[model samples]
Target: MGFLGFLRRSRHERTGYELYGAAVAAARDPYFYTGLGVPDTLDGRFDLVGLHAFLVIRRLQGLPEPGPALAQALFDAMFNDMDVNLREMGVGDLAVGKKVRAMWEAFHGRAAAYQAAMKAGDSGALAAALERNVWRGTPAGAAAAELARIALAQDTHLARQDLATLARGAVAFLPAARAVA
Candidate 1:
């Protein structure tokens, strides 16, 4: 690519990283772990990140042109972070790719489930999917429903945001603490 093309690509990558960072921050909210009863383990954290990423990506998919590109960047940014995290956690070099691929499949499946549930306006389906994935098919009391509510709220909030703002990597998630109430 030429200079301008390289610059544009770099800018998109930077925005993708920023957006992914926002999703991670939202996923790490104390309310989700402490107040809502989400497990505090690594897998739990991954599920939360996947949830937040799905919210952003779902909205991005509906826009024109640069929307798809930005969505791809966001996906790339997320997997890149996962790859780095796995390495940091001392996964062997060869194992990292396999692990990342498994994670990729998990994220895709979860995202698809979420998209379908929300599109059909089936909160119960969303909750069930959350329970199965987030709670590992174990009982979670009201936590799964609460999480479903929060995810719906965040999705609505994201849907209203302008593409331009999102393209600039300026995305905001509704506070999970308030969503629980």
Candidate 2:
């Protein structure tokens, strides 16, 4: 690759890392688990991060050039972070790879389900998906409606961004007030 190619790749990687940071930050908001009834557990947190990442990446897939590359890099970054997190949590090195691999597959499946629900263009679809995935078959209880509303709102927020801005992989999540948070 030439110098310009190198430069572009660097920029793409940076954007991906930035987008990953944004996704994780949004996922870390206490509202989802504390207020929205998402279980405050490892799987729940990973699902939330994957959800936000998918939201932005779905938008990225529509772009022409670096968008797809950046989208992929962002996905990698999420898993890379997860790998490090596992290590920090004292997961054995040999087992960490297996765990991360499982997480990647699970996240991919979740992303597909979420994208399909979002594409259905109804809050009901998203609600049902969340109720199934996040709540794990049981009803989401009082937080179901609010969580659904936020997902819909976040989707709209993503839709409103210009393709160029989105290509930069910098997504801003809309913050909603919650009774618990």
Report the number of the highest-lDDT candidate.
1
Off by over 4 Å in 1: 1-11
TM-score of model 1 vs. true structure? 0.93
Candidate 2 to truth, TM: 0.84
Q: Where does candidate 2 stray beyond 4 Å?
A: 1-11, 167-169, 178-181
**Prediction 1 global C-alpha lDDT:** 0.91
Candidate 2 residue pairs in clash (backbone atoms < 3 Å): none
TM-score of each: 0.93, 0.84
Q: Could you tell me how far off, in angstroms, the CA of residue 113 lies in candidate 1 after the best superposition?
A: 0.9
**How well is each residue in 88-140 modelled by candidate 1, as lDDT tens digits?**
99999999999999999999999999989999999999999999999889887
lDDT of every model, 2 decimals? 0.91, 0.79
User: CA lDDT of 100 in candidate 2?
Assistant: 95
